[model samples]
Target: MPASGQTAERNSHLKAVGFLIGGISSFQIGATVAKGLFPLFGPTGMVGLRVGLAALILLAIWRPTRSGITVQSLKLLLPYGASMAVMNFCFYVALTRLPLGIVVALEFTGPLTLALAGSRRWLDLCWALFVVLGLYLLLRPETMAAGTMHSFDLFGVAAALLSGCGWIVYILTGTRIGRMFDAGHATTLGMTTAGVLLLPWLIPVIPTAIMHPWQGGMAISVAVLSSAVPYILDMLAMRRLSPRDLGILLSMEPMLGAISGLILLHEALSVARWIGVLCIVIASAGNVLTRQKAIAH
Candidate 1:
């Protein structure tokens, strides 16, 4: 490439990185606000509102037509959308019992596992061990004895695990959808599909909540911050950056979530828990870096 083109490319890459960072920060803030609204709307209700409103907003922005959409694309999108809906619902449910930081950290396991999969290197195994050790430290019996884990809810933990599983499915199915359509079209259709799938749960609660203006407003905010903004930003970033680079950037999300929880919800973690968070972040970053190196070879 020519010098001018190389410079332009570097600038665009930097701009995309900035957008990704902003998107992650905004997402954590949205999650903190959503947790506060759990009293007015249960987890499922909040999921309904977020997905429903997000679908409307994205559809308006994209104005996707069925002209190019094929039945095969629709097949890919259905499972992708369903995975998204289930992931969000389960994460919110876990949030009700656990602090925002812990839930986010636990949820990080999904992507970390994805990143580490198919690796045969001993170093990769070591990185995976760090993740396991970190999680153990974060949720171990000693932490509970110190009152640092008092809020631990077994059901919430299980729900978070389920959310992680959903996340893996979402990523796999979404990759296929991304290959089939542009991000805007794919996201709009997928979110709409998720909204439709969630109707049974949403229909029962949204009608009453819509009557009260305050509840409805909060729900709209959640949709914008959590779904619309982050998704758009992530898509932009993905266009400029390699998946390895994107994964490394995404590894910062758990730390950002922990900070947001502390500042917004006054949720504090013990020293041990902080160590645990650091371990997971390091392990994730290391895994991505290693994968990139392997690709270079």
Candidate 2:
């Protein structure tokens, strides 16, 4: 490639990295706000607000038509939308019940599992060990006894794990959907469709809450942060960053979540949990660095 082309490529990669990081950070902030708002909205109610408003905004922007729908496309989108809805629902459920950092840490398992599965070299096992050790530190009973963990919080932790699993499925399915449709349109339509699907539960709750300015603000913030802004940036990044690089960069989310929670929500982490965060970061970083050359091919 020419020098100018190489420089442009580098710039694009940097933007993608930035977008991935920004989106993840916004997600964490959204989580912090939602957690704070949990008392007012309840888990499902909070999700309803976020998804509902996001749906409206995205619908106005993308206006995706179902013109491209086929058995193949529907198969992909169904799972994609389902994964997104379930992931949001479960994460909100977990957020309602547990601390933000713990929930995000546990949720890291989803992408980590995908990373482990895709690797072929023995070196990948080293990264796997780091993630496993991190999970152990985050989830183990011994780690909890130090005032950083609660027994009752385990249920939320499990739900977050389910969210992680759903996220992995969402990523996999979304990749296929991306081939068939514009990502912005697809995500917009998918999210709106998910909102419609959620109406039975949301309609009963959103009305009373929507009348409150504070609750409405929080919901809009969640929509902009978690859905609108990130989705837009992710679309830009997708053009520049390969999927593997995107995953690697996206793995930084847990650490960002922890830091954002600590800073914005006044949540604290014990030394062990901090160490767990480091381990996962190192593991996720390793996956990126090790796979870089391979993925570019």
Candidate 3:
């Protein structure tokens, strides 16, 4: 490439990195707010309201036309929406039972596993070790005994694992969906579909949640933080970033979750747990910088 083209490419890469970091930061801030709202509305109720409201917000922004809609799109989107809906619902449920930082750290394993698959590297082993160490620190028998300690709640843990799986699907599918639909339209329509699917549960709780006033505010706040802002920033960043780069950026979610929980929700991690978080952060950053250098070469 010519000097001018190389300079332009460097500038573009820098811009993409900035957007990715911004998106991750926005998402963490949103998580803090949503977690704070957990006392008012349970995670499931909060998720329903968030998705429902986000659909409306997206509709206003995207106004996706039905003209280009196709059977394939519907088929692809059905699972996508379903995964997204269930993911948020389960994650919030886990939040109700566990620390935000721990939940996010475990949740990250799904994507990290995806990142390392089929690629043999010493660093990949290191990443796995980091995750395992973090999980052990967070879920040690003694650690559970220290706090209110429902960390081992089988159902909640299952729900969180399911959410992590769902998120993995979401990331994989999002790339394809982005190719076919504009970000605003894709996210809004998909969320709307998920909201409608979830209405069956909402039927019983909607009236009570909304009428409660406090629950209603929490619901809306979750939608804005967990869905709206991060969704927008992610959409913008996705336009400029690759999946590996996006994954690397997303690895920051756990650290941000820890910090946000500590500062915003007054949740603190033990020294061991913080070290575990550091390991994961270093592994993730290493992967990103390594991949980036390879791309540059």
Candidate 4:
């Protein structure tokens, strides 16, 4: 590539990076706001309300056509939407039991694993250890007063871990969908599919949302911030960033979530979790900084 082309490519990567950062910040803020609403909506109900409203909002903005409504699209959209639905449901379920930051940190392992899989480099191996250490600190928190270790909510931990698996599917299928359709349209349809998948749960949610207009307003705020904005930004970013790059960049979310939880929700992290997140953040950064050599292949 010529100097001008290289400059343009670099510019594109920078813009994509900005989009991802914005998406992460918006998502954490939205998660904090949604956490406040969980008391009224419950975790499952919140997932329904969020996906439903986000689908509706995105549909209104980006109208879809019937041209690409082939079996092929359905095959991709189904898994994409299903994983998204599962990811959000499990995430909120874990959020109900865990701090927002902790849930995010644990859930991040899915993408991190996907990104870092099959690496042969010594640096990658070292970075992988940092990730493992972070997870260890997360899973094995400080000891209690009685000399026994503090045990986390097992269900929440499992849910968070499962959500990470769903995240892997969501990222892979979502990127494919972005390539096949307009990113905005793909996001709209994908959210709609997720909403449909969770339609049963929306039964109770719809009534409560109607009865409490204030809660409905808050749900809408969440829909815009969490699903609508972030999904679009993420899909756009995926167009430019390889999955490895995406994973490395997204690894920052745990740290960002911790900050958001602290400042907005007044949730304080344990010293162990803070150190864990710091290690993961360091690992994530190392991968990105050393990515240039990997690109040599």
TM-score list, all predictions: 0.92, 0.89, 0.83, 0.88
lDDT of 4 by residue, 168-241 (tens): 99989988898889878888888899999999888788889999999999999999999888877987798898
Alpha-carbon lDDT of model 3: 0.74
Question: What TM-score does model 4 achieve against the real structure?
Answer: 0.88
Which residue runs of candidate 2 sit more than 4 Å off their true CA positions?
1-14, 118-120, 142-152, 242-245, 294-297
**Ten-residue segment with the worst summed lDDT in candidate 4?**
288-297
| TM-score-superior candidate, 1 or 2 | 1
Please list the C-alpha lDDT of all candidates, in the order they appear: 0.86, 0.80, 0.74, 0.88
Evaluate model 1: give its TM-score.
Answer: 0.92
C-alpha RMSD of each candidate structure in angstroms: 2.2, 2.7, 3.6, 3.1
Per-residue lDDT of model 1, residues 184-224, tens digit only: 88889889998999887788777768787887898889899
lDDT of 1: 0.86
TM-score: model 2 vs. ground truth: 0.89
| Ranked candidates, highest lDDT first | 4, 1, 2, 3
Backbone clashes counted, model 2: 0
Off by over 4 Å in 1: 1-10, 143-151
lDDT score of residue 30 within candidate 4: 93
Residues 1-297, candidate 3, lDDT per residue (tens digit)?
999999997888778778777766766676667676656555666666777887877788788889767998888898889888878788888887767776777677676667767867676677678767776776665435557543456666677778889888887887688788877788877888888887765555678776788767666666676677777777677777787777667778788878877887788888877777776676676667676676688
Candidates ranked by TM-score, best first? 1, 2, 4, 3
**Candidate number with greatest TM-score:** 1
